[model samples]
Target chain A: MISIKNLSFAYKKKPVFDGLNLQFKAGHVYGLLGKNGTGKSSLLRNIAGLLYPQNGSITVNGFTPFERLPVFLEDVFMVPEEFYLPDISVPDFIKHYAPFYPRFNSEKFRNYIAVFEIPADSTLQNMSYGQKKKVLISFALATNARILLMDEPTNGLDIMSKSQFRKILAEALDEEQCIIISTHQVKDLENLIDRITIIDEGKILFDENVETITKKLSFRFAYDAEDVAAAIYSESSLIGNVIVAPNIDGDEGKLDLELLYKAIITNSEKITKLFQQ
Target chain B: MNQFFSLKRFTLLVLKHWADNKKRYGLSVLAFIGLLITWFVFTMLTGFDNIPMGKAVQQITFFLSLFAVGTFYASQYFRDLGSRSKGINFLLVPASAFEKLLCSLLYSVVLFFIVFTTAFYLIDVLMVAIANSLPGTEKLAGKPNVINVFKVIILRFNSDSTINFLLFFFSVQSAFLLGSVYFEKYSFIKTIICGFVAGFILFCMMYFFYEHLLPNGGFHKGFLTSFRVHVDGVNDHLVQVPRWIGEVFRFLIMYGIAPFLWIVTYFRLKEKQV
Candidate 1:
């Protein structure tokens, strides 16, 4: 579990995040939704204790992350968008890094690597970017950390690898562990993330469960724009129009992430009010 | 158990770094050996006597060893800052700031001293042995006494002598550490510039206050008079401060600069972007 209170950060005199407060609970996968330059990465880094906020404090599992106590560090892991693995082979990295993570499951790591098709003998530096990310992600999961922070994890992966990534992530989830993933590609995390947290202008706009959202709003196709009545938000495609309408009929429909994202950003107040109702 | 785990983590980190850069470490060792050979050849070609060779070798080795240590420390520190992979991996490890600081300090100070001193002694002994074996090298007959050399080295760090050395060492390290943490880009150069700028600014402030703002301030006169008397006495060949006091004052000054530098570095680190 993680809690951030009134967090504000600045670069030089320019503010990046201000008065941001949010809490995350364990046992669910969280999709951190945001636009470019929305301080998504910065927020992840702050939670990871890699970057210190100019104001506010972040606590992970009741320990201040910035303090970076062993207890806090042992239970948390962050996988960034870009990473480098030393020239050492996978085995060498394991030999050197496994001791630091008390719960490190070497067997699981080996299994995951095999599943991911990462060559054990290949030097990490020699691998492709996606491969390197896979190794890091696999290793991160193997650590059995209580909390995991991932930033743009599927940025450079091929479509197959992205699905493979989702499968691996889904399989890795447990009741005791929480994973917070920040990415612009909501489609990548569709059906995988249980909760969604949207950030814009350095502030969290909404934090709602997928089930709650689907129950309150219905995503349906309308043949004509006129058929969509008092919808929260709608977008037109070649076939028809997709609209988010109030669940007044108490209809439970599949949540449309793309439309929900648009509604949250374009008409956030209306969406927030609808959710409140 | 936790302490043991922490130690294991530290060792793991060091081993990982070594494994990753084994080639670089090997090259550094090879370069040092080459330097040793060059020193021996130069002495032989110049026909320098044993005493001169000993003295020159001692001074050169001392400096060379220091340079080696400084280069390794600076390069590793800066390289980590510049490296995205290494930096992220390092930060990911669940260690306290104190533990991280201790590890860095150990690498810069304790490990460096051990490596440099061992290399210095080994190279010195080998060079001396070769010199003694050469024709017309009778002047190099007397071998360096190991026990005496060690005693000299140990005595140099006595309470009286160690103060100044420690002060200077800490000041330099603090400057480097601050630089490593402050600038996300071009940290090495920025550190140097920041140090110079800080020193210059302090100098100017002192000069202004003493020379223009308060031309006849009694505080300045008293301080300068005491400083002058101290310097004059040390060189007068008559009255001098006791050796112990001199050593202690030297150490105090060196260490005094460390906390201030560390405080600044800490603030800079807190504001780090990455």
Candidate 2:
């Protein structure tokens, strides 16, 4: 579990987060949705102790992350968007790095790599960017760390590999693990993320669960002009006008992540009020 | 399970560092040996008289290479921290700052000294043997012999006291190590420039304090030991600090500097962010 309170961080003169507060609980995959430069990665870095907060504090599993104590580090793992891997074989990497984490599961690591279709003895330096990313993802999951922070994890994966990533991630979770994924490709993680937290300009615009979102909001195409004008958020598509509206009939429609994101960004006040009610 | 210091974690960190850098380390050692051989062969081929690979040559070669290679190696030890990707990898490793600093010292100071000394002596012995066995070498005025490197005194400021060059080398190398953590890019060059600037400032401060602030006197018994001043047509008087104070100062200068720099390096590493 993680708790952030009144956290303020900045890069020199540019402020990233100002009096921001959020909470993350175990047993959930949080989809951190934000436009570019919305402090999503910064938030993840702050939680991981890779960057110091200018003000306030962040506590992960009852420990301050910036202290970077061995015990704290062993329980938290971050798969950064841009990562580095030593120029060695996969086994050698595992041999050297896995010992640092007491909970690392080698069998799970092998299974994950096999699912990713990575060669057992492949040299990391020779692998493509996507392959290297997969290797990192597998290693991150296999660490069995209590808290995992992933930034743009699906950036470089191929189409099928994205599906593989989703499947592996879904299988990797447990009741005690917390995963916070900061990504722009929400569709790649459609069924995987159970909670959505959208941020803009260093503020949380909307934070809700999939069940609540489906229960209160309707996502579908509207053929009638009256439906289109009455919708909270609507966009013209080639087939019809797609819209997101209040779920008055208790229909519990499937959540459209992209449309929901658009709706929040464009008509946040109404959607947020609806959620609050 | 100890957070600050754990033997198991420290050992794992050391082994991991070696695993990641063994190839680079191996190549560096080989390159150093090759350079030493080339320098020695050039000396042996060019000298017409006397012992070409004598004590003087060995000492000069040993100290020069030690300073050059030692500082460069120390400056590069933490270069990974300069890049975002690499810095994340490094700082995220499950080891305390103390353990990380110890690993850096283990590689940069302790192990480096052992390996460098061994490599130097290996080349020095082989090259001296080759030089002494050359035909007509018996006619030389001096005998070619391998020097006891530790006993060599490169800095003899006074007749009664001699400072060990190894201490000076370590102190300077530690400064560069700290520089590697402080500066993000071009750490080696930046550290060297900063060193020169700091040295110049310290020299100026000392010069001004002695020449303008103090009486018309000069330090005759080495630096900071004793001062002799003219007393207006009277017998000159010598002022000196207590023997214990002098000894303490000497101890601090020779041994305290490296450990002091190491402490600063540790704190810098603890506060490092990516």
Best by TM-score: 2
**What local distance difference test score does each model get?**
0.74, 0.93
How well does chain A score by TM in each candidate? Answer: 0.96, 0.99
- Model 2, B15-34: lDDT tens digits are 99998899899999999999
DockQ (C-alpha based) per candidate is 0.47, 0.86
Q: For candidate 1, write residues A166-234 as lDDT tens digits.
A: 988888899999999998888888889999999998888999999898889888988865657577788
Interface RMSD per candidate (angstroms): 2.5, 0.6
Error at A175, model 1, angstroms = 1.3
Worst 10 residues of 1 chain B by lDDT: B220-229
Q: Candidate 2 chain B — worst ten consecutive residues by lDDT sum? A: B155-164
Model 2 accuracy (lDDT, Cα): 0.93
**Candidate 2: regions farther than 4 A off:** B48-50, B156-163
Worst 10 residues of 1 chain A by lDDT: A223-232
Pick the DockQ winner.
Answer: 2
Error of 1 at A174 (Å): 1.1
